[model samples]
Target chain A: MSVTDELLANNAEYAASFTGPLPLPPAKHVAVLACMDARLNVYGVLGLEEGDAHVIRNAGGVVTEDEIRSLAISQRLLGTTEIILIHHTDCGMLTFTDDEFRTSIRRDTGVKPAWSSEAFPDVEDDVRQSLARIRTSPFIPHRDSVRGFVFDVATGKLNEVR
Target chain B: MSVTDELLANNAEYAASFTGPLPLPPAKHVAVLACMDARLNVYGVLGLEEGDAHVIRNAGGVVTEDEIRSLAISQRLLGTTEIILIHHTDCGMLTFTDDEFRTSIRRDTGVKPAWSSEAFPDVEDDVRQSLARIRTSPFIPHRDSVRGFVFDVATGKLNEVR
Candidate 1:
């Protein structure tokens, strides 16, 4: 089957696991900004249900312009009041330098000027930096409560990094 | 020091790493729905950068009404053309039965009239099941491409399970 067909199959079984209709709280909602790593299981860690939280993720769980836009929507429009930022140890962002990543992309895509030194660079600093940017961003409701944590990919533990 | 102070210190250092401005690409954007588990790193696996993708996540990385809402917005406004569902091995989604989770939340939150059974549930099937849901979701854009993968938390590797 094609990739699309496969995705449908997986989602079907996943959906079937939910025997009942789990919904989110309408009044007090939470938003999570986390890395795209597979190791940090936010639901299991937080003891959450299917619709309990709003999670936004990216590499290193960093805050970007789009992330800010989404955060603003979640807080101002969607009723999300608390924000959790989760970074992790042994991140791939720590593995390579920006120059290295650009080189790899150039070789793979065969595109001249593939990405600048700043494009894919700066993974290691994304976590703490992203938290600050999100916390202070005027776009996000200033009153929202924001916290940051570091999830250990190897240990499956979360520590309050902020 | 206060959490705010820490956030500022780390973020300032983090922001200094961005030495150059990067350009945005016009390629079709992809949305990755995955688990919040700390074991998997989506960036290194996908080789992504800032402004490249949208990641919506939950406990098992399972799709729910809210996740769908986010997906709806992501596709309707954010120019996303694809969805990638990633589930992983040794997930907590498979650890506790639904009864256990409901009981725990009830005891802790003191909010009875237990919510839907779909809250935090088990992940029984493999990658194929997750893939099927994404492909068949009526709400997902028909033109969008969707795929599924299972990441091994222990090995830090991913196999296209679907």
Candidate 2:
């Protein structure tokens, strides 16, 4: 089995034992955008339970189209009013230049990666650029509150970067 | 101090201890959309380090607008190509129905949640609903791979649900 497969199976085994669902806190329904890095234990660090906050994760801890659509629905339908964006330290997404990544893809697959960049060539601008994208998105409810942060994987903590 | 303040301080201290960036793996940059359940550990289950995958989180692992904007930049600038949507068992966002959530907001904040079924509904369909959103999102590159899973908070296992 692949590493992902092994991981998934192990997770299922563990989950089967939870007998009952964990207790959830009465927090203001919150929507958080965070990175998917395995090192970040968001629940433990945030002192949250299963039902406290809604979390959305993607590459580079950056948001994507589906995320926006969901967030729209979350605010419109779900009880989430707060938006917390969490990026993390030692992030893999920040490690490579676009050219380097493309080259790796070519070397591995014998074909170049098939994505485009309206603002590539400028590798250093990713953080600010991603932040801008979220802040200005039209799909976000105009009346909702939104905030961003950077989480450090090694430390298990959060930093308010936005 | 507030829990958030404490975590923020911990994050800063942890970040200061890093000598330099950690090594990044050559794996295809994977983006994960996961729920914000405190019991779930993305790092422990996935065996990921400080820098591995990109994680975007929201309530019920549902996608939203802000998430989409971030994802667009991730695809456009960050090196992400695959998406992993993780919804865990015993999610809190599921506890309250749309009316309950909206009622809670009204009682606490004195404002009604916006967006109606005409354009947006209060209750999200489910993990299946979330998966469909990812599959049809326009921002995701047509060639990039997107997969969805359900993470069991009790077991730390992720299963492909879509």
Candidate 3:
């Protein structure tokens, strides 16, 4: 079986014991923007149960137009008032640069990407940058509790980026 | 304490038993795109362990330029070969049209959002739409095992979007 099939089998088991159809809005009234890193399981890290908070993720957990769009909808429609941002150590994004990645993709695919790869030299700086993006945005209504953290991959601890 | 502080407390417990850093690349060689719904815990739904797969999420699990950027980075930089697309039942995306959402944001903020809100009328159709996005994109290298599904929120079951 393909790995997809294996995961599907796992899903069958998950669904069997699943108790869901929770209310539409997040119970905790928070939204989390985190890296798409396989290791940073947002649910586990935050001790969140199902239906707790909106979790938005991307390549570097960097804020972009798309992320702003997600956050706007999250708070405006869903009523999430707090935001948590998580970036981690040993990130693949730290391994490359935007110019290098865009150049490589152009050479391989003949189409240069217009978007910034959002590769950052420093994780904490990027976290602060992401926080700024949310705080200054007019679309997002709530910015009172926006916080950023750099999670230690080795220890799984979140150190606030203050 | 605020909810963020509460989650920080949870993180202390998580880190107490936390193990050392895993490798940068996903061990499962898979990438999952799903909605930013709180109820659809991607890890629990797919029985995914940390470091198993890359999880990208947004408002609708819809494919956009940023998602294309993420998938490219995942397939090219990392070694993930398979892609899974997940949209769920009773999705907030189905509640409004893109035009309506855009208009509301424009009226509220006095500036129109250039990005599409990506609201869809149907869930399964949107799943197929997201799947076709990956299949047709030239940037993503490995598209052999791309699949799409709709998690039935009421049943906690994932129904494959055929």
Candidate 4:
């Protein structure tokens, strides 16, 4: 069976005892932007329960225009006042360069993407970059409340990125 | 204390007995793109453990250029094959329109965004759009294995979307 089917079965069990209908705005007025890595449990690692925070994730957790767009809406409309950017060690993003990945994809598929992969060699540096992006964005109203961190997949630890 | 400080303290407790060093590639060969709603535990509801699957999340879990970029790398380099697009009920995306939200942000920060918020009227239809985006992306190598679902945040249930 596909993993989707397995997950569907699992969701059935989860739904059987589900108790929710959490508030629309997060209780803490916080939002976390973190890597989509399977090992990093943003909520569990951070001790956040349902309705506590909004978690925005993508590969590498790097801030992008789209991410800013989301954050704008998150803060302007949803009452979120804080942002946390988290990137992790051993990230696939750390494994490649923009040029090399572009070339690789170009060879695999006949089309070349116009956007950069936003890859970086250092996870902490990437985190700092993301933090800066959020801090400087005109759309984000809670710039001073933003911070960044690096999650160690092996140790399950998060180290602050300045 | 900020939520980041609280999360750091929690991470210390979590890291004390942490054990990992899982292989770089996910064991399940699947990637799930879901909303970053604090209530939807992507891993728990899907019965996924660390190192099993890659979970990519954003505001609405909408398929954007960056998401496709990430999927390209997920499939081309990391060996992830199947893709699951999941959107949830009562999403913040459902609370406003692109134009209305743009107006709000513009009013709040005097800066007009150049991109769309990707807001939608129907969560199920948004799931279908994301699925189609993945299925048609030239960068994604495992398009044939793509599927879509709408998760019920209130009930912890996921309904397939065509």
Q: Please name the candidate that would achieve the greatest DockQ relative to the true structure.
A: 3
The DockQ assigned to candidate 3 is 0.88
What is the lDDT, from 0 to 100, of the residue A123 in candidate 4? 86
- DockQ of each model vs. true complex: 0.05, 0.24, 0.88, 0.72
DockQ head-to-head 2 vs 4, winner: 4
Worst 10 residues of 4 chain A by lDDT: A41-50
Off by over 4 Å in 2: A1-21, A26-162, B16-19, B22-27, B107-110, B116-125, B142-144
Query: Could you estimate the TM-score for every candidate?
Result: 0.49, 0.57, 0.99, 0.97
Q: What would the per-residue lDDT of candidate 2 be over residues A1-162, giving only the tens digit for each residue?
A: 344554456555555554444444324466666555545545544555445655566555555555564565566555566666666666656655657655654665466645532223322344456557766765555334565676655455565653
Local error of candidate 4 at A14, Å?
1.1
> In CAPRI terms, where does candidate 4 land?
medium
How are the candidates ranked when ordered by TM-score, highest leading?
3, 4, 2, 1
Off by over 4 Å in 4: none
Off by over 4 Å in 3: none
lDDT of 1 at A55: 61
lDDT tens per residue, model 4, A7-76: 7898898889888877778887888998877778777778777778888887789899978977887788
Which window of 10 residues has the lowest lDDT sum in candidate 2 chain A?
A116-125
- The full ranking of all candidates by DockQ, starting with the best, is 3, 4, 2, 1
Positional deviation of residue A151's Cα in model 1 after best superposition, in angstroms:
20
What are the clashing pairs of model 3? none
Model 1 lDDT per residue over B1-162, tens place: 533343335444443443322222213366777765443444434544444566666556665545554564455434577777787776645655556644654565454323332323334354455566656655456444666677655444455653
